[model samples]
Target: MIPNVIRRVEFQYCKLHFLLRTRPLSHVMYSGSTGLVTPVADPSLLDCSRAAAQDVDGFAIISNFVSSEEEEQLMVDIRRTLRGRKYLYDHWDGAIEGYSETEKSNWSESNTPVIQRLKAVAAAAVTDKVVVPLEQVHVLDLAEDGHIKPHVDSVKFCGEVICGISLLSDSVMQLQHEEYPDRWIHALLSRFSLYIMRGVIRYKYTHAIPTNENSVFKGERITKQRRVSVISRTQPVHS
Candidate 1:
């Protein structure tokens, strides 16, 4: 299988890695302009609700989740939080080397006031579900051409519902499951938007942001840009 996407690398930093589409050596290589060949997805697995898009199992994509002014404030808070931290260039792929993965952090959630507002929004989104205590906060600073490979968060480090707020750019989030790994639902995540993936959507399917993916928002097709994603997960409260 081959994907026909081309990436124009805007920035390449130390230890920063990019995912290039490739098949195992077992498959013969013959390159041409073939279309994206993916299996037909099960309709039951996808929920494309655009207006504050959400699914029954708790996956959500809320446009304008926060206002521009609020976004600016959040960014300021984030910059402050990241100002004195040291980031390692090595990508953790559950291995030593050769694999480049997303740059991540678990320390930002506890120090920011903006996180409190995001917590409230999550509570309101899933009214039936109560917001639990904040677990580890995962932050990713991706350059214009940066993106994530498809994978799920380890339950050991997180809990049921996961919420993330996008800042500074718009991108498409691709979701898929083990049963239909080849198929995906490309959802648009606008800047200042909040998206939650939970329940079956969280466990059954893996989510990713592709480097070259384009999203249509306000009827305009826009390319992916630099992004700062602030992610939080819920922790099971033990009494």
Candidate 2:
């Protein structure tokens, strides 16, 4: 019993260390009962998995999940793989243009370490018992003028959790509730940051990156640039 207790404590401590790399500038949530928006003071996981009344439920982010050196190396791998590839301008919303995307069923030998690192951090950050990365890794490159419009992932495509690593540049992603438009939050994704969306936020909120204007977070304007994201989603569970 004593040895089991010790192992549990160690696990929690390691999970905390992986999550609290940087504080979020702005991560507010809507209070359904009071009909007011409240700030999620800290999103760090303290005890085992569940914490009491800590509002920011489905969305979480670690500002710096990977080191600068690792980020550069990922970029190197991306460029090598996507050399001379043509960007697509086809989308139903017509929200994105001059963007290139590819799905990697498996990572190369050089990228396996980083991929494993992402999986490890993702498992530690969320409350879910099982977090399985999908077979394909979604690699998306947005040109200087490209941005993602507000949209939700198809239920058939992926499961409850979506984890992504921001590479090359910093940007802002806004989440607005589908029913209550006023209820929203802005997540500032810094370079090399990792953002995870699950449960309610994944199904209900529509996320988008604005291109026409500067993004505001904590009263600071964020300008977008050429950005690349290495994203992985869990396999969709059939209901």
Candidate 3:
């Protein structure tokens, strides 16, 4: 079982622009360039008020999971490899679909050296009982304001454990539990951060990034920076 500090956190407000005022609790605020402000409530103090209670979802966000140097080099390689490649869509793949704007996929199978490095890192990161091979990995690129609607990965295509490594800029991912539709979890995925979702969190939840605004927090609307995500799965369908 994960420790108490690592438990799930629930946020009171879901709006892109809102302030959370809780006395005696330290708050961190992120300002977007569009003059929108999102106030991050103190998770520790969130337990006090019953009225402030929100749905709790099992999603883990680990900031700075990869070193800065590693993230930079990986992104550089991704850009170089994608320059001349054709982007395609396979309906059989469930994580993403439909007329999405400015996005690319399937770098995990590319011959780029940086992609090779990513495979190495993913292999090393899977220390659990389930060993996920590199062949099941998938890479994605999202442009500014690009959004992916809420959807769950097909059970057959992914492992029991799913890991997403963020590269460049930041994004707010919203997740909802199928069993508890009322409650949702919003996470700020920063550059080099890794988010791991498993157990009920893995199979029972739907996740997506919103497309309306570039940044969720006020005054934080910095220009959209190209972003990449390396998705690693530990449980292969064939094995």
Write the residue-wise lDDT of candidate 3 on 122-220 in tens digits: 333333353454464566776654656778877776665666778887777766667765655666777776665655556776877666464453334
Q: Which stretches of candidate 2 lie over 4 Å from their true place?
A: 1-55, 92-95, 123-129, 212-214
Output candidate 2 Cα RMSD.
Answer: 9.7
Each candidate: RMSD? 17.1, 9.7, 12.0
Summarize candidate 1's per-residue lDDT along 87-112 as a digit string, tens digits. 43345652111212132333233234
Clashes of each: 0, 0, 12
Top TM-score model: 2
TM-score against truth, every candidate: 0.60, 0.74, 0.58
The reply for model 1, stretches above 4 Å from the true place, is 1-57, 84-90, 94-113, 123-131, 181-183, 213-221, 236-239
Per-model lDDT: 0.52, 0.66, 0.50
Model 1, 126: alpha-carbon shift in Å?
Answer: 5.4
In model 3, where do residues sit more than 4 Å from their true spots?
1-57, 85-136, 212-224, 237-239
Error of 1 at 46 (Å): 8.7
